[model samples]
Target chain A: MQKISPLRSSIEAFNKFKAARLNKADKAQKTNQQSQTNPFGITFKGTVIQMDVFEKAEKVNENTQKAISLKEKMQNTGKLLASAWVGTINKFSSLKTNAIAFGNKIKDSTIAAAKKIRDFGNTKVEFDVFKYNVSRLQNKPVSELRTMLSNELQGVTNE
Target chain B: MNNKRVKNIIEALGKHKDEESIEVLNELGTNCPIDEIREMTSKALIRKNTHRALELMIVNKGKGINDLSARVAMCAINELLALKDKQEAIKILDDTINMHSEKEVQDTARSVKALMSFSS
Candidate 1:
């Protein structure tokens, strides 16, 4: 006896539902064609479908693909932000030798990058997670900040 | 992932100081990889104003990710501040104006600060 995985079962169920719905739509189209009749004994008639079914199906499939891509991106939100943060920090440290000469420019660029990171967190992170993160951040020491982000990055990547 | 308990604790924190409870909830919300639970807790924190709800809204106002929630939270924060502790709210907005480089965020802070000033 073989055991099926829950994820596999859920996917199977979704595919079955989708197939059944599509079949019903095809059957309905056929039924509509069969129900068409001519009045006054005029028997010469043909059914003309306006919108292409295949096109509609392709459109639906495209939307589904887009949705799947969005989900994948959402899952990577933590990692993306984490990498950005690390990159910004490294850039700053490497430029420390020229700090006096490029002070204003460095500061401005760093602030801009930081703003982008915050924007990413605020937008991409779910609201509850955002709130929780804000509160959690208040309690943490500055030294431990990277640990938190790294953990988030790991969790997202691991999944 | 006990969402019900998290909700209850957040409600309690709104009324009284529960440092440990808030800390635990914050940890759960931060550490949980599950999207749905984190979302529920985020909403809970916003409604209670336990976290940096207003600050988050101010920073994220222009970005399209969670506009509706941010708008609603901004309104709620405005009302709450308008009723009490207006100075702190004004200071927060002022900091946002001075510190943030994003034009959208600065504009949002300026408008909200003006509205608060007018209302008060």
Candidate 2:
């Protein structure tokens, strides 16, 4: 007799979530690579402004590169924030982060990422769990995104 | 989770809140579970029949009103404050303060007065 596993179900769900996220990341990276690769000299604010313009864009823009630039830069920010909070989110997988209730399996292992994810929590979760992936990624993080941008400005100044 | 309890709260909003009724009704619009009671309470006060709202507050006597909790109280108080009827809020709040004892509820009443003063 075959027995169904709830634990397996959650794990499968989690795995599927991870794969989709990575696939989105791949598409974003491909677009940016296709656009223009900035070898360590990318201005964070420039990317932020571009993303802001892309976000406010209701339809396709005259410049597809601008859209991809925003999407790619945002992916970079997401990874950096997640690295900061990996600790707490991994510790408490059972508890749902109020900020990002559905999207982003917020374990205790990651705080900064989860918080950033939560800052955009309203848009972070999958609408149909697989139907529409990363659509909400367009909302953008105003605060952390600004901070990352300001730091990039500092880097530019020193250069 | 409990729809049945919710219906009862809507019904209570229609009636008077006695000691026994307020205790049970207080549990409706909070972490316990959200229900139409929140919507109904706000709606009932909007009619602005100050005479009736005050009557219910006094009749209930503040026994289990704390079970009604702070947020609901604050919401209702804000409505009353909007109508610029401090007497009604003051009457209910002071009555609740004298009869019942909860720091949150007390603070809400105090804040309402502060807010009203600031506006004036």
Q: Report the number of the highest-TM-score candidate.
A: 1
Candidate 2: regions farther than 4 A off: A1-159, B1-33, B55-74
lDDT of 2 by residue, B1-120 (tens): 333333333343334323332322333322222323454444343334355444443334231222255555555555555655566656665665566465665665556556766665
Q: What TM-score does each of the candidates earn?
A: 0.30, 0.26
RMSD of each: 39.6, 41.8
Retained native contacts per candidate, as fractions?
0.00, 0.00
Query: Which of the CAPRI classes, incorrect, acceptable, medium or high, describes model 2?
Result: incorrect
Instruction: Please list all clashing residue pairs in model 1, or write none if there are none.
Output: A128-B42
Q: Is the docking of candidate 1 incorrect, acceptable, medium or high quality?
A: incorrect
Residue by residue across A1-159, what tens digits does model 2's lDDT show? Answer: 988799999999999999999999999887677445444434665552233433555776658979898999999899988976885676566565544664554554477777787889677564443321222211333332234323433343354
Model 1 spans with C-alpha error above 4 angstroms: A1-159, B1-6, B16-71, B78-82
| Candidate 1 structure lDDT | 0.55
Task: For candidate 1, write residues B8-75 as lDDT tens digits.
Answer: 33444333334353444445543455554344444444444433544543465422112344544454
